[model samples]
Target chain A: MASSNTEPVIIVEGLTARYGEVTILQDVSFEVYRGERFMILGGSGCGKSTLLKHMIGLIKPHAGRVVIDGVDITRADEETLHRVRSRIGVLFQADALFGSMSLAENVSLPLAEYTDLPPELIREIVRMKLGLVNLAGYDNHMPSELSGGMRKRAGLARAMALDPTFLFYDEPWAGLDPVTAAELDILIRSLNEGIGTTMVFVTQELASIFSLGQRVIMLHKDVKGIIARGTPQELRETSSDPRVNHFFNRQAD
Target chain B: MPEMNHRGYRLHVEGAPGAQAAVRLEGRLALEDLKALMADLQAVPVKMKPREIAVDVAGVEYLDSAGAMALIEMENLSRSLGIPFELLGVSEKDHGLLCLIDREALQRPPLRPESERPAIVVRLGEVARRQYRDVLEIMTFVGELVAALAYCLVHPRSIRWEEVKFYMKRAGADGLPIVALISLLLGLIMAFMSSLQLKQFGANLYVANLVTIAMVRELGPIMTAILVAGRSGSAFAAEIGTMVVNDEVNALVTMGFDPIRFLAVPKVLAAMVVVPILTVYADFFAILGGLIVGITGLDLTAFTYIQQTKSSIRVFDFATSLVKAVVFAMLISGIGCQRGFQVRGGAEGVGMSTTSAVVSAIFLIIVADSAFAIMLHYVRH
Candidate 1:
């Protein structure tokens, strides 16, 4: 691992997703540099989630490829998809944990799903994850028992359970308290420093995006293709996309 | 899927010399005239064996049993008159009508016999071959479910015995009291109903025999099973179905654990283990219910009732009932788990799959129980 700034780790070329007669994304192209906490910032219904979905291989693009770490995940088979997906941890919008299981169980799910580790080792990994989220003692609590912040933390723990190379957080600050949000941002920062993990945060939550993202790719829905991609300060001062400022509109510390 | 209309008809009249015909029909035929011709045949003034009586029905759109019965009567009349009768509109729908009157009407003439038959099975086979994976998937799920249980025996720790225990308590023990109560009341009701009728014939003592025979041979095991199936079986479906919809199954799959081995084996094992036990309890309560009836309604002593039950109910009969319970247990739980794991999409899909599981399981249980009863019947004889 270089552990240094380098070429983009993710590149989307001429990407589009279409229904019968409607286009969701149109010939969109972008690149995410290595070690950059690059964000795709857009308002709701602006294809932000759709773009993120394409990146994680949940939904395939209509006409382009998602090249992640040099492997094209656009048309991957199950094993390939699993491998690619495991490398990219996704925090789904609603925290898609298995409801029947407890917090520790949820965090351990990916590890349990993909590893051949003994139960004892799996328990240790789960303990380690919960501990990272400051949820060290809520291991046996069901998802329903956790508050919004706690649930998000548990979900984060699960997402980070596999020690993914890249983390994708979808609106992680949407429903959390400011204190919790700030704590989460610090945790994310600590995680980045500690593991040197690359991150792609998809959010219109301005505070979280600005505080967490090192660079940003703003989506502009003009009659043409995507309008801009740049660093936060460069985007804040000089970006021409009207949608760009709108994403940063509700920015509150 | 089916449509109906009431509309017009027309009649035409034609026949041999001196034959007079009048139509009782009142409307214009949708197209050509056939009623007038039937009237022509009915007039029959000549009282002669005409070579043939002919009617064209090609324009007829609607037909009634009256119209069809008239045709039947006219055919008999033709046999009497020694004239061959002919109907022109021999389309498929018309042929169906003719078949209703006389099945031979649908039979093909020698030249067209093979041509008219459907290519349904061969075409269906081709379609099945093309959609073979669906068949393979179903087979695989069923195979894996069975293998999962087989795996459980050798590797019990791999199966989550705790979850199975949880479901068994929910599905079996908690539900057992109600099931037992209902079976008991059912035995009392059957005995009471039969006692009213049999008392008229002064055969009150045989009521014990009736209750014993019916409960052990048919009602106790079947009713108790059906109650449990509807109660606990549907619960199994809904619970597991919810897990499936919530991506728990996918989570399991990604974890390198076979969901069937992880999920289904436990539920299947629990139900298979518990249902027969529940059936035995139901049997005990039902006998108790009949014994209560014997003392209060029939004036027969409890000892007499018990004696008659013991003397009449054989070990083989009890075995048959218990064996049926065990089999029904397997069927209900297996189908319930199968449906649960097969859930697709949201709340509506889970609900539908649960309903289907109950219906299919109940029907299969009844059918298998009937077959088992018949085999036992033959063996006993």
Candidate 2:
């Protein structure tokens, strides 16, 4: 396995995204080293989704660059971007599961669209992915029927369907109960060990980020960007930045 | 008290020719006094146009946030009443002070000159919105449905048929009573209203032809389609709107399933399946209404009215209406569900989407009925 020191799997350099005159993200530079479970932490409207969109090539950077797997995604062709995306799994915030589709259909959608596998083989793979997420028996369930955690787990199952080397989880633990959140944390760790995939997470929930992020990157709302990045423990004791201190001091707010 | 009126300021509110209201005030004429003066001006006959409040604030000094907020309120109220509001006869120092405090209000874009102003973009939001007439939209919807059905066949279990049945019950079954009632009411209404107009000519028997022709050929299908659209169309929007607000739509998208295909497909299918049945229910009630009108108003027998209806109603007429109802149903359900899925906000979004769905469905149903009528006219000719 290539260590993070050898080369970074994802790099966002001085990236900015603007909606009309309002700049949501400004000049952010960060790297997700190979095999690292990277986390981006901020409150709502802090442009975390905007950052994710830029990193995943869904959006073009306004004034900078995003390089994923040695490709300059800011100016890359659609085919090139698709190839890069095919190698990564994205578990979006809200899980983004289709309400019209059953659990089995939702999990198997990616393979149906992108793979040449036969229907029987596809079904088997879908079953395996659901089994991994502990949603195997609920294949016929609609998204409306699933509990919030089960829906997220189902989304995770779909993400794992592609067997990608890099995974991005956007607020995987959000809106989940504490027990379900803990279960997601366990799933994240197990998935990391089992697939050895590089991971990046965006979340405001501090406990999961501290427990799951191999390295955490703190994004602040004002002009300064990427204010702090470090191991969770290192951030807890030695961080001197007031924003970092306030964030780590861990008030209920 | 009379001496206090004499010391009060002489204010000239300029530009509003018809709306000059005088204020009676007392003392130093501070900005607060001016504000009170403006408040009193509201009682004036400034209903038609620009209101002019000329305050002589020369006697007083200083304006703060409260003064500014009051002036802003005045500006807003005057604008709302279609009256121009201007301050005049004020000392230069006080004018500058007032302007400084109400800078935002002062700098708003003034009404444009007739030649330079951009023409108002006129949108009906209601007028001329028939799904059938908009061939491009119809084709796009059909294309989307085809894609969804194809996807379903490849992933049969992806759609929970039971959930679809749940929605179907709401959209189709629940809609029947309302659709039936409206169709019945419509038939009676058309028969009575047209008879009242035609009765002046002593042609009460023609009410039979009129009701039969109008109900079976036009009003029955059209009204039934609209009623269903309002009821079921709104329901579809609410269902999809709630799903969207709750993030179920996003979850589907993340899971590699297109929400349009998943949520929209089954709804379109259900509508395509149910609209014809609803139309049949509507037709039966409408004919019944016509029969009642014929018996009571004209002193005619129910037997004669039925005989006339049976003889006059063509198989083509019935089929055409059914065909129109199916098309209208598609129009109502498709537009409603599509608009619902487009909702963006949370709870308010669900409400907005539901309202839009009903409005669009009704509008589209009317437009579709007319277009179908025109088509039938041309084909028959």
lDDT of each: 0.72, 0.71
DockQ for every model, please: 0.01, 0.01
- In model 1, what is the error at residue B185, expressed in angstroms? 1.4
Off by over 4 Å in 2: A1-6, B1-381
Docking quality level of the chain pair in candidate 1: incorrect
Give the chain A TM-score for each candidate: 0.92, 0.94
| Candidate 1 error regions (>4 Å) | A1-204, A207-253, B1-138
Q: Per-residue lDDT tens digits of candidate 1, residues A1-253?
A: 2224868888889998776677878988888877668788765566788888888988888898999988899977889888877777888777876666778778778877866556654665566566666676666777776787888878888887766778888888887889988988887776665554678888877677667777777765553345567767677777665566555555422
Against the hidden reference, what TM-scores do the models get? Answer: 0.43, 0.46
For candidate 1, write residues B105-196 as lDDT tens digits.
21212221212435999888878885586457557777887777787888878878798898788778987889888978987998899999
RMSD to the hidden true structure, all candidates: 28.7, 25.3
